[model samples]
Target: MAQIATAAPGWNRFVGVSRPIAAAILGLLALLMAWGATSDVGRDHVRVATSSSPHFDGLVGDHALYARIAQRVAAGESYYTTAAAEHRAGDYPLRPFVAVRLPTLAHIVAALGEKKAQLILLLIGGAAISAWYRRLRTEPDLPRAAAIGALFVAANLTQLAAREWIFIHEVAAGVLIALALALYRPARPWAAMAIVAAAVAIRETVLPVAMLFGLFALIDRDWRAAAGWLAIGLGFAAGLAAHVAALAAVTTPADAASQGWNGQGGWIAYLSFVQASSLLRFFAGWVGALLVPLALLGWAAWRSRLGLAALSIQLGYAMLLMMFARPANFYWAMLVTPTLFIGLVFAPAALAELARSLRGENAPNRATAV
Candidate 1:
C-alpha cells in the first residue's frame, strides 16, 4: 500500500503536467484550424473575382509600395532615400509609408511574398498567444481557470480572419501592443517601448497606446521607463512631421481628390452594417461568445492585484477610441482586444470567488467546495 501510494502521487504529478501541455497543444490546434478555414474562404472569394480589380487584389497600394521598397533594397538602394522618394511622390498610402520605413518588419514582408508575410504574422500571433498562456499559468488567483481565457484570446475569430487577409496592419499591431503590455510586469521597460513604437508606426489610429504605456510607467512610479516611452513618441512625431511636410510640398491641393481618400465616417457606417449582417462580423460578438468567460477570469485577477493597471489602461484606451476617432474599420480597436480578452479571462474567476463568498455567508454550516 505504501509503495502504491508513492507511485500514485508520482503518477498524479505526471498527469498534472501533461494535462496543461495537452491543453496548450489543443488550443494551438484550434487556432490553426480557425486560421486555415478563414484563409481558404478568402482564397475562394479571391479566385472567383477578377484579379485586375483593385478589390480582388490581395495587397493593394501600400502592399505594392512595400514590394517596391523591397525590390529597391534588393537592388542596393538606401531605405531612407527609397522611403523619402516614395513619400514625396505620394506613391503609397499614408499608413503603408509609415509601416515600410520601420526596417525590421517591412524588410521581412518585402523579402517574402504577401503569402509568406501572412505566415510570419501568424507566427507572431502564436507567440503573443503563447505569452498570454505563460502569464496565465503563473497567476495566483485562478491559475487553472486562466487557461480558458488564454484560449479565447489566442484563437479569437477576428484574429483568425485578419490572418487570412494579408497586409492587415491592425492584426499585427494588436499582437505587438499586447506583447508590450504583457512585458511591463517583468520590468523590461525598453523592450515594451520598442513594441509600442512598432504598433504606433503600423497604425497611427492607435497612438493612444503609446500614451497608455507612458501612463503605466507613471502609475508604477518608474520615471525612467516613462521617459523611454516619451522618447519613442517624440521620434514617431518627428518622422510623421517630416513625411507630412514632404507630402505637402509635392502635391497640389486639387490632387488630394485623386488620392483615393475616403471619409472615416462612411467607413465606420459600412463597418457597422457589416457587423449587423453576420454574428461573426461584429468584433464584440467574438468577445461575448468566446472571451466573456475569460474576462471574468481577468476580473478575478484584477481583484487579486495581478492585472488591474493593465485592465484600466486597456479600458481607458477603448473609451478614448470610441469617443474621439471614427475608426476606419472595426479592427482599429485591435490594440485593446488582447487586454479586453485578459479582462474576460479574469471575469469568471472573479465571479466564482464571489459566489463562494455569498455561499459562505448564506450557509455557514454547509461545507464549501472549490
Candidate 2:
C-alpha cells in the first residue's frame, strides 16, 4: 500500500487508494520489518543447539536430503526404511510422523528422473500462469499497471521455479492454486476440484485451503462448487488418514523421537537468522521475514473473488507458523512466500479501493468496475 494505482484490467483493475491510507499501511509494514530485523527472540540458536531433545540434529537443507531420498528409493529400498534412517540421522521427530515428508516428490522424481520430473512441473506452472493471463484478457478492459504487474508476477514465478523454489513441491502448489483460482467457474467445478486435489497431493498443508474454499463456495450458494470441493476434501482426508495410520503402525516406541524447541523464543524467532548454519540460507530467511507483513497487507487488500481462497490459505498458514515457530521454523516463511509475492507487488490499488469504500467514495461494484 505504498501508493494508489491500479493499472490492470479484469480481476485487479480497481487498486487505486488514497495516499494517506496507503501511507499508513506502508508505515505499519515498515515498522514490522524493522522489528523483525532488530529482534532476536532465539539468538541463542546461533551459538548452540536450541532444541532440548537429545536426538534433534537440527534442520537439514532438505534439497540434498530429498535428492538422497530419491536415490535411495531408486535403489529399491522401501520409503519408510530410508525415511526412518534419514530422520534418525538428522534427529528429526518420528513419533506420529511429524518429520516424515510426503512421498509425492520423491516417488515422482524416482520414477521419472530429476530433469524430466521438473520439466513436467515447470510446464504445469507455465500453464497455470497462462490460464490466469487468459482470464484477465476476457475482462473487456486492461490497466497498464495491472497488465505490467501480471507480467511481472509471471516472470518472477518462472525465475523462482528455475531456481530453489522449484526444488520444493510447494512451488507447484502455488501455481496449481493459481490455476484453481483461474478455473473456478460454475461450469468447471470438476476441473477446479481436480487441480486442488493435485495441489494437496503435492503438498498436504493445502488441505485446509481446499476445505475453506468449499466453505466459501457454500456461503456463495454455489452448490456445485461447494459439493465438488467437498467431495475432493473428503477423499483427501481419507487418503491422509490412511497414510498416517500406515506410518504410525510401522513405527515402534523406540522410533518416537522427542520434538524440542527453544522455549525462550515466540513468534519473533524469525529474526534470528544467524542461528542458521548456512550464511546464504540465513540471508534468505531474513528477507522472507521482512516480507511477511507486506504480504499480509497485500493479501488483505486483494480484490479478486479468488482472493478469498488465497487469503484463507495465506492467513491460515501464517497462523500455523505463529503457533509453531522456532529458530528452524523461520525458514518455513520462505517456503510459502513466493506466490504471496504476486499480491505484494500489485497491492496499492486494492488498498485504495478498500479505503474508498470506507470513506463513502465511489467504490468498485464487481459487475461494472472493470
Q: Which candidate number has the best TM-score?
A: 2
Sequence-dependent TM-score of model 2: 0.72
- Go through the candidates in order and give the C-alpha RMSD of each one to the true structure: 11.2, 6.0
Window of ten residues with lowest summed lDDT in model 2: 273-282
Model 1, residue 51: what's the lDDT?
18
- The number of the candidate with the highest lDDT is 2
lDDT of 1 by residue, 1-370 (tens): 1221122111111122233443553354345334433332211111111112242234444444445555576567765666655544543333433333454445555568657777766776676677777776655433344555566556452453443334446567777776766565636678767877887776665577677667778887888988887888898788677766654454444332322323233322322322322233445433243333334334423532236556565555445543443323344455556556556544433333334443343212222111
Q: In model 2, how large is the Cα lDDT of residue 301?
A: 58
What lDDT would each prediction earn against the true structure?
Answer: 0.50, 0.59
In terms of lDDT, model 2 sits at 0.59
Candidate 1, residue 43: how far the Cα is off, in Å = 24
Residue-pair clashes per candidate, as listed? 19, 11
